[model samples]
Target chain A: MAGYLNLLLRLTIWFLLTADLSWDNLLLGVTIAVLLPRGATNPGTLKDWLYTLGEVVAAIPQAYKEAFEIMIYPHHHEAITLERAKPRRTPSLLFLDIFLITFTPKTIVQHYCEQGWYEVHRIQRRPTP
Target chain B: MINILSDGCMIIGLVFWFWGTWPLLGQRSVLYKLHSLSVADTLGSMAIVMGLLLRIPHEWPLLLLALISLAIWNTVLGYVLAYCSTREIGHDG
Candidate 1:
């Protein structure tokens, strides 16, 4: 499953680079995509993949909102907070979680501890009237 | 109509860039500055790239790829920098 996903991702990059849809180009792309060695086996289910993708899509609007809110100059509170992670969370999920949090302007994940805690730096901005 | 939308995108992106960059001169911490930079550099660049895509639909493949790269790389780079810097600072030290 992950192999097919990796293939699709590689193919997208190939198509974007070549920017052509000729039959020969398509054949060549498919050949290259298939022939390329896969990365280290990453444990992920299709369901998990779709869920992560959905979460990412949802975070886009939230990120924009946070970006605008952070621009507001007001009395904001900054703090270092510890967020607990799921003990069994996989590396890919951890990556996505860190990305999503940091992508928003309000919070950043500074480090992930072996104890399953995320040290987060967060800015709490008050809404202006 | 399309022209207006493309122009609007460019303008919005410019606004983001300005606002995001404006905070660097203040007394904000390094993390806060990084957050702002990501918003400006990543999201703002994506918006500008999209505006260009609307303007030059023929070169969409390249622009789209650039948009994706900007978004992902900027986000990751910001995280990595923050993670590394804060680590060396000894957390709350």
Candidate 2:
């Protein structure tokens, strides 16, 4: 099945990244790859993987833009509260979102507010249209 | 040539590390300080690891792991700290 293949691919990558060909290390990586994806509410398909990869690639430039903005204009602090339009976000997606936003220096999610709104603290407020 | 590139990456990483810290001295809110520190820390650490990756290509496995860990754990820690602070404020007031 697709899921099994995905798991195998991830395990292989993990093995390479760890660069340890020992039995113990290989066992650990296999255990993790098998166990973790099983917990995902929706296991990733090839399309999903490709889409996420594209999103990450696109985000690189945006991240750099935000980082430069933070470095150049570091004096101001603006609190912008926004609602999560989506009905629900998976833990994985939420964590990914947080990591992506926080990786850039401009914004940080301070608190998950009532009514599905998130209190995001920002360095610069968006301009009014 | 490789040494020069590695040194350059390390120097740039140090610059990012300092840039992230310079905001801490300011009278910013807790969230603001956390944001600056986390961003700088993550990027700087990754850059340093990248320099190491370049300096010793054979050790990339370890350096890559370091980079990935820095990205994941640093962001998670920031979120945890922010959540705790919010909870404390809610409890008191």
Candidate 3:
């Protein structure tokens, strides 16, 4: 039930973004939304999706702050290796994680290894320690 | 009042766009330059779009699409460019 609803919502947003209420465009949006790969069998409830959206919105200020810091100071490049420990890594969750992390100017995912590790490149001022 | 806010956003966006370029001329690695460029470009573009959105509220649908595209495609492009550079280096060595 939730999956279908989610699909409908996405389709609606797609239509709005296109600003075309024509039948053909509406059908196309529905087709594309249906054809796209969904995350998991049971993605999540609407509340969960709303929570995630809120988190993303809250992070915007932090992203802007980091961008300003990088611009103002000399930053050194470093790669932070990370391992994904989650047993069930949903595609949607992974995509969201990558998008949020990269949205910030301070860090970007450089590589994702098949061996379950991610090479994230970050820029920061040299530590005083 | 709205005009003032929109102009402020546009000016800040332009500043960010120009700020990103300064690293290119410095003694930084390709990755560093790419990092600065992508970050500034994304934020600056988004800011400019926001300004436009405020100025022309009626055309928000297109502007919103532009913002989404900037967020998604810019990050993907950065990853692709970095990956290609690494592959090229591996080939040479």
Q: Number of the top candidate by lDDT?
A: 1
TM-score of chain A of each: 0.83, 0.60, 0.65
User: Which is superior by TM-score, 1 or 2?
Assistant: 1
Relative to the true structure, how large is the alpha-carbon lDDT of every model?
0.83, 0.70, 0.75
Least lDDT summed over 10 consecutive residues: which range in candidate 3 chain A? A83-92
* Residue B67 shift from truth in candidate 2, angstroms: 0.6
Better-scoring candidate (lDDT), 1 or 2 = 1
Identify the runs in model 1 with alpha carbons over 4 angstroms from their true place.
A73-75, A126-129
DockQ of each: 0.79, 0.60, 0.60
Most accurate candidate by TM-score: 1
Residue A129, model 1: lDDT of 35
Give lDDT tens digits, candidate 1, residues A44-77: 7887778877988898889887777767654267
Clashes of 1: 0
Interface RMSD of 1: 1.1
What are the per-residue Cα lDDT tens digits for candidate 2 across A28-88?
Answer: 9988987774643544455544555577556655755666667776546466567473345
Task: Summarize candidate 2's per-residue lDDT along B1-93 as a digit string, tens digits.
Answer: 999999987887788789888879989777878867865787777778888899999887677777777877887788778778877877998
In order of TM-score, best first, we have: 1, 3, 2
Residue-wise C-alpha lDDT for candidate 3, range B1-93, written one tens digit per residue: 999899998888888889887779999777788778876788888888899889999898888888878877887777777777766866898
For candidate 3, the TM-score is 0.80
